[model samples]
Target chain A: MEPSDEALCQRVAKRDVAAFELLVERYQGRAYRLAWSIVRDPEDARDLSQEAFIRLHESAGSFGGRSKFSTWFYRIVVNLCLDHKRKRRWWKPWAGDAADDQGESFLERQPAPVTDPVDELGREQTMKDLWAAVDRLAPRQRAAVVLQVQEELATYEIAEVLKCSEATVRVHLHRAMNALKKTMKNMEKR
Target chain B: MAKHPETDLVPYLRGELPPAERERVARHLDECPDCRQDTDQLRELLGELSRSIAEPPAVNWARYRAELREKLEARRGRRAWWWQPVPLALATSLAGVLLFVAVWGVGRQVPTAGDPVAFEEAAIGRNLGLLEQYQVVERLDLLEEDLDFMSDLDGLAAGRPG
Candidate 1:
């Protein structure tokens, strides 16, 4: 059986490098995805994820077993992403224009390898748009959307990640959805 | 019919509505083609959005792990000495010494707030003494000329008066 996250975290606190390796392997993809979703740059995503792990190691001794390990881990990712966003200007792509015929050529040239038909053209267009929408969202709203819709985290879990009340998470999601609809409408018009 | 539904659309899209509200909205959606169309569009958008899975590009995990381990080890080495009781005293003393030196250097480099005024007063006093010596004390010829002129004036005034 796989070791529990708490067990791994406990070991990690004691400077167990192997345990940390396991933790990284398990969460690196999610961490990178969250980072990329926020910053919208592959290189920055990788670096941010790595930095999160480094911070995780440094802060391991302080992880009380109050919440799920993923919850704590996601909080770290969110903080790092926010910091990256604050530092960068004009790095994230605009959402609305990716659906033009120009983007079709780009997509064809460099397709994601997840060859399921569901992951094909329509879905890719939407994903690109989704990132654009996320990029346009205010920071808190974006964090809420990413944690809820993309990460599939519940409101309470999102609250933990964002350090806010569940009601606040819902508020952010509501506002973010409104913004997204408005943006997507404009994009469709274009 | 209102252009938009009374209910917030997102919770409804997520199927998070209460039974009474859901029924109310459902009844409204049935009559209002616009609301129906909006719901359908939102559903399609959500469908499209669900495709954003957590996929990362391929990386050499073994190498990455190794490098991370090395970095952690180096960090550990740097901080491990601080945690030890034996070396902590020495480290603390060294830190105190460095701090003292830094404070002394800054103190020497920066004049106190009052020091400039004191310096200006001393410089002005020296300049005034130099001026007095050059113009009055050191210029004996000029002083003697002034004295002779004053005596002549006094003699003329006395001759006129008596």
Candidate 2:
């Protein structure tokens, strides 16, 4: 039988390399995907995910079993990604406009006229628009949506990861959905 | 019509609502076309979000592990180097020396040989006992003079001064 994540985390606290490796192997895919979902950049996701594991290794001993290891670890990754977004947001005004303009033009150039609602459901342009809108959401709101939709975390678990109340998590989801819905309506009009 | 549970729809779609609330929302959805459409739209959007978000590209597990191991080893090596007996001793000694210098430097008021004020202060400190004795001796001399004057007066009274 495989060792549980909690069990492995305890061994990792003791600097058990094998246990740490096992934990990393168990979580790497999920961590990378989760980071990628937030950052939307593969290289940054890989680095951020790796940095998350490094932090885990360093701070494993501080894990007092108050929360599940997964929740604690997710908090670390989410915080790093959010911090990265904030730092990027500072420099974005100078370096971001050209790339964003190009991306917008490219997206606008794509032909996405669908006669049937069912047909629109699977269209590539719709997916792109949906994600583009998701990317544009406030970092916390976007994180909430990703946690709920992609990672399928429960509201309480998301609250734990986001270090916010469950009601706040619900609000984030509500606001994010409203924005995405508005985006969908706009896309439909377009 | 009941209030639209706009806030609860996402949680409802995610099935995170408590059973009673879930049932209530379900019944409401049955009754309200507007809410039902909203729920359906949210559900579709969530579904599309899950389906549309691309998977992270496959990483080489062996390489990933190797790179992480290298980083870990380098970190450990740096820590070990700092803790090695020679370096640790040297660092401790250096820190001790710095602390000693800092304390001594702050507290040091050693008189320089050329500072006249310091020299004078030191000289006065050394003669302090002598100075006190001199004061006592001077008072004793006055007392002796007074004694002589009295003795002269007594001699005059005794007719010895003539």
**Residue A30 Cα positional deviation in candidate 2, in Å, after optimal superposition:** 0.5
- For candidate 1 chain A, the 10 contiguous residues with the lowest summed lDDT are A96-105
Query: Candidate 2 lDDT, tens digit per residue, B41-141?
Result: 98888888888876777888788778777777787788897878999999999999999999988875667888999988877776778776897879989
Per-prediction TM-score, chain B alone: 0.39, 0.54
* Per-model DockQ: 0.18, 0.58
Candidate 1 lDDT, B88-145, residue by residue in tens: 9898999999999999787644435679886776567657866656755558878898
Cα displacement (Å) at residue B38, model 2: 2.3
Supply every candidate's count of residue pairs whose N, Cα or C atoms clash at under 3 angstroms: 0, 0
Please give the lDDT score at residue A116 for candidate 2. 40
What residue runs in model 1 are displaced by over 4 Å at the alpha carbon? A89-127, B1-12, B15-39, B52-56, B78-85, B93-162
Name the regions of candidate 2 deviating beyond 4 angstroms. A95-122, B1-4, B19-36, B78-80, B83-93, B112-162
lDDT against true structure, model 2 = 0.83
Q: Which 10 successive residues of model 1 chain B have the least lDDT summed? A: B1-10
Candidate 2: DockQ?
0.58
